[model samples]
Target: MKAVLPSITSDLDQAERDLREHGICLVSGVLSAEQLADVRAGLYRAAKLDNRRKLAHSGRRIDHGESNQHVRNTLSLDPVFADVAEHPAALRLVRSVLGWPALLGNQSAFIAMPGCEAGRLHADQGFIPEPWPTLPQGCNVGWCIDEFTEENGATRFVPGSCRHHRPPGEGDEEGSVAAVAPAGTMVVFDSRIWHRTGENRTSDQSCAALFNWYTRPIYRTQENWFLSLNPRILEGASDELLTLLGYKTEGFGKVNGRSPM
Candidate 1:
């Protein structure tokens, strides 16, 4: 079960190399101190708004068994969230793993609270039936708003597991390591890698992580952008944003054989 730990680097070239060889890479300093602070605050603000709405309707927590809060459809929650999703650093890595025609599957907040239990270990592409292709069908970018540490529920990854063409089984957890990195780092990993959220053992601090997931254009996105994005956000989207949202026509997204864009 022994495996090499994921490579951590500030250089994109090194990160790309790690991704291809190790299945995971941590790109340090993807955000400035000020930017990280703003995103951290934005995450809580969005959580508060979502909580208020849920409380009004007696809604149960989406993460029922986990000691964490989930904020879905973050793009329309705040301007900062949209900025996080469209960050140049993230887009570059995503396209590298998932191809230029990648569509943003979703942008959401994963706030792991103190005492949170470790999550179910699995690959992001597990839904796709095996034998899995060598090429990844998706990529997941984790934006670390708070310093990620094993004590604070950092994600765990089984290094080089992306090379496995099939999903993990009963004993795969033995090889995993926590993806420790500083605040403002961006964690880019191939969706085929086996990963899970580590347990939060801290007394007070919550791990504020934002995940922007992308997929090949042939697959439908997790969030239905057409129905969920705020109208104003759509109106003001850049051409690249539109393309990521699946507004631009690729080979399969055509409407009656015509380009949607």
Candidate 2:
């Protein structure tokens, strides 16, 4: 079967190498059935809220009939997603890629309806200059909510293209491959890799995946966590997650010269 670094059974150094060599990897069994069930329950509740309110208040757009409906600012939505964001293997890889003291850049749910067009094949670092510098900017972890098939928009990406340092060429996609994996898998990819969502070709079908973006802690997050997040969600958060969300008192996240207590 076609694959891209399937279900990492190797050591972490090897997994890190795989991330550099393949620009992506899939770690299997990141979530057990019970945890998955809880996440789904929370996601359904949030999706229903988004669907009803149109996600207008979240500082992100939610078009009524768009092919891809993104539930942005998901960290502030519910607590079950915390399990996915702070997953150990994923954090290890993201920290290795983005360097120590990494931070959560953003998290969201992507629901792709059938016939969704191919997203632009681009690198996540494009927000910076071309020929990206040596330092890693960010990485992405996609928590699969359903079977990710080739025809179900299972993340199309160029293999070994992390070294490209720039946007992909027109012909690069001709060799692109789908990240086919099971529902409970974590799809990890470097921000520099060239990727896009594959078109969903099935009828009366849709696919759902969660994006948990992590970075080197200096970059501005896509969503404003300080103001948007519900304070109640922080009642039982772990220290690692609190830090990832920039609850620390130092650096850019500092509040009025006061540090995180």
> Which has the greatest lDDT?
1
Query: TM-score for all predictions?
Result: 0.92, 0.88
Tens-digit per-residue lDDT, 52-156, candidate 1? 777312335433334677878888876777777888888888877877877888898778889887888888888898789889898999988888998999988
Encode model 2's per-residue lDDT on 111-148: one tens digit a residue: 77787777777777778876588655889998888778
Candidate 2 error regions (>4 Å): 1-14, 56-65, 250-258
Task: Name the candidate that leads on TM-score.
Answer: 1
Predicted structure 2, TM vs. truth:
0.88
lDDT of 1: 0.82
Assess the local accuracy of residue 127 in candidate 2 as a C-alpha lDDT between 0 and 100. Answer: 82
Off by over 4 Å in 1: 55-66, 255-258
What C-alpha lDDT do the candidate models reach, one value each? Answer: 0.82, 0.76
